[model samples]
Target: MLSVESLSKSYGKKEIFKDISFSVQPGNIIGLVGENGAGKSTLLSILATLQSPEKGSIALFELDYKSKKREVRKHIAFVPQDIALWEDLTVEENMMFFEKLSWKKKGKEELKQLCSNVKLDRWNERVKTLSGGMKRKLNLAVSLIHDPELLLLDEPTAGIDLKSRKEIGNYLKKLALENGKMIIYTSHDMDEITNLCDQIICIGEDPFYQEILTETGKNILSF
Candidate 1:
């Protein structure tokens, strides 16, 4: 559903990555791996259309991102590394806010169902009162509120308990396998990559250091 070709990005004097190319299809769970400062999030930011690449093209559903910004955005949802909910808002309030922002206001029942799928059970609890894991799920729930076809997650599982991690992982897998959502996510933990992704892309200091994980996610080798 997404295609990127010859993508290049750099800072003033330092090059992050260049000549990068990849495509993601519906029902594909792509894991992005890289060392800190290796530009994983930067790459994701470009894919989310929050930033522009110096060179190359990004297309979503055959629509050129450069020219069809609004069309592509309608199909993409990005969950950043930081929590994006008001700490004082109750669960219902938080979902409602995002739903309205999506320009598609779903009913409370629909919103509650989204929270339930993310394993967030407290509808009346304030955001600050929820556990770290619940917060993560709530973040995800907010992203799904729009029902976008492409989901980009940066450290979605970070700082959550193990159970929550696995739960979130399984739900993501379900999104790909059953809901036919295309997912691109990043994590420091290799195991999360192994457990959730159908393919893995690794970035490193060497510009040529690109590898795709096996379908089982058991191994990574050059394409």
Candidate 2:
């Protein structure tokens, strides 16, 4: 489980979010929605342990972010808004590079399977040669190289075609339901949000922080 309580952050005199709280259970696909300056990316960055929160606490699987930063990171993966890859490298090379950086290394077969999961079969094709959607898919595949339990994505489907978007959405759903991985992603597509997310967390601009269940007759949590 993921527990966030009274979370707050600020930049100098500017406050981003204050007293934000929520919890996510296993196998839940959460959609984080807000305006441009709503701090969606900021929140994800904090959760990913890339930045420290000025106040509040975050715990994943009972591990506190402050005291167990390294351990927590082992089970967490963050896919940033911008694709992080070596454009000059091939698909397999990129995967190998990220795998080497991970704490837990995966075998060649395992790495190949990860690529297959995203349908990225062009092992020798350079990242620069792949299309936008393929690159996004490859980005996701690389993030999963460590087999993290929690996945954080930022506009993963942005600039992708309908088919590619659907493929990525399907793969995410599979990972959550079949693999029991927790997913939190930020997106502007309502249709995608409605179709992929089990719950929606609205932040920034919105006076009341809320978590709305996408499923009918489900309970809604608001603060």
Clashing pairs in 1: none
Model 1 lDDT per residue over 1-223, tens place = 8998989899988898888888899999988887789889999999999999999999999999999999899899999899999999999999988888885679989999988998889999999999999999999999888789999999999999999999899899999999999999999887788877777777765434343343343534222
Error of 2 at 216 (Å): 8.6
Against the hidden reference, what TM-scores do the models get?
Answer: 0.93, 0.92
Question: Candidate 2 — which pairs collide?
Answer: none
The stretch of ten residues in a row with the least summed lDDT in candidate 2 is 209-218
Q: Least accurate stretch of 10 residues (summed lDDT) in model 1?
A: 214-223
What's the distance in Å from true for residue 184, model 2? 0.4
Model 2, C-alpha of 111: deviation from truth (Å): 1.0
